[model samples]
Target: MTRSGTDRRLSDDEMASWLPLIRLVQLLPQALDRTLREEGGINHAHYAILVTLAQDAEAPPTLGEIARIAGLSRSRLSHALDALARRGWVERTSCSTDKRTGSAVLTEAGRDMVRRAAPAHVAQIRALVLERLSDDERETLTHLLGKLLPGIESAV
Candidate 1:
């Protein structure tokens, strides 16, 4: 009853469902990135890093924790931090108690930038995604994606 790899292929029904999801996955990031760049001179990844830091602004978390929360690899996080640091929007610092551990601190400028950029980002998201779906459809989509998240997370 097992199908060989060579024999495996998506059925028309499966392709019908998958094609839009594939397109959405690829196009959504580009769309969001365009908005982010225009509104704040930052891309989605940089915005994610800033927002992650801002979440714990009062007591910045370690780089490792930030990496996990921001869904970025450590090296990518380091590179993003370098850009943010150079822009004076973030500062990388050692933990006072743990010399070997480091944290990304969101600067006042970063906070201000998020404040200014968030509204536009939200509006764009609404325009591109949320408003397009009915409430029930949105809820169903959220539920379906949540089911897929575990497998996707594990792959990463």
Candidate 2:
């Protein structure tokens, strides 16, 4: 059987589960951005870029790879990299095998900055997010969200 029109709306149970999650999805990034800007002098975008690069600092990944990991478009990542480069925190080099391709390498300064920011950033996350849930709830949340990621990624 097929339902139509008003019958298509979310059920009460579904709404109860979704509303808070929707709000958190909308607002958490802003809160984290505010904290990061105040404490680290960087916004979440820059922080994400730096963190991704630092993960493979010895062999920097290509811009496309970084873009995919950071969930940013190439143009947006390029702009952020430009700003970081001006701050002397990251350097971009043309790929040795393909001059048209580029990769971002974290500078010593960038590595140090991420290291300095990590502890406080993690603390902020704990205070705002993790501390709100019990250990079992946290585990369940991770498991539930992980189940959704593949579908979400494919939809995009």
Candidate 3:
């Protein structure tokens, strides 16, 4: 049998590393989304936005900054913020530093939602991931993924 020039295949070691990560990446978000929606009445993306806003108590970052930190595109963040705003969880306002820019601020209701969701969300995460790992394994995984993120993010 002849192989095509473009038909590079995954080696066993690569598959061993990548296959599980691929499955986790694909399914974990859905699981988290479901849990957050059921327990907190919000999906994961909206939850992420709320968390981003909660990071700074005194002032909010601009939309672009939130996009960078949350790993969301501008449009996605905007839409999520819109949903949150409609729910009285988030409010977008003109940035004080840059009037042309906008920032998202978490409302009291939003902070309460995050507080309510955190315990369940954390439990779900532990059930799905952390419980399966030894502490050392978890630390190693975090180190490895931190090293991997820059390359992956740059490609996007």
Candidate 4:
């Protein structure tokens, strides 16, 4: 391909590695959302919030913390919190010590939702990804992705 001097295009070998990663990044979320919505009436992001809250059941994390962990902006997290609250799956409350600080608590129904939805989600992940890879392939992919994550996180 022709390029101007300033254009530093990827080499063929780089494209070979990047193309599949790009496609997987683009497609996997849509596929997960479809299955999650079909199975539980919530998209993957909402499910992720539920799972994260479950992980910190003893002390609910603040909205900012949840947003950071979930890679969502504060505004996006607020919107999601509103929806989850409406569905009776979550309750958002201001911290007693600092009224300006807000945290999310998963309801009993939220736990129930996670319980009912986890099986289907796990199955879809397995079918679409894990089952397709050998043990060694899975390990290598995990290592490579882990190496990439710091840069990705920093960019965000």
- Best prediction by lDDT: 4
Model 1: per-residue lDDT, tens digit, 19-56?
Answer: 99999999998998999999999998899888888884
TM-score of 4: 0.88
Cα lDDT tens digits for candidate 2, 7-113: 86877777887898899988988898998888879988889889998884446689988887777789999999999999999999988889999998889999898
lDDT of 2: 0.87
- RMSD (CA, Å), candidate 2 to true, equals 2.8
**lDDT by residue (tens digit), candidate 3, 1-156:** 444568689667767878998998989999999999899888887888888888856778889878877678999888878989999999889988789999978899999999999999999999999999999999999999899998998897
- In candidate 1, stretches whose alpha carbon ends up further than 4 angstroms from where it belongs are 1-7, 56-59, 96-98
Name the 10 consecutive residues with the lowest summed lDDT in model 3.
Answer: 1-10
Q: How big is the positional error of residue 98 in model 2, measured in Å on the Cα after superposition?
A: 4.0
Task: Please give the lDDT score at residue 130 for candidate 1.
Answer: 98
| lDDT of prediction 1 | 0.89
Off by over 4 Å in 2: 1-7, 56-58
lDDT of 4 by residue, 1-104 (tens): 55466758877877898999899998999999999999999998889889889884556788888888766889999999899999999999887678999988
Q: All models: lDDT? A: 0.89, 0.87, 0.88, 0.90
Poorest 10 consecutive residues of model 1 by lDDT? 1-10
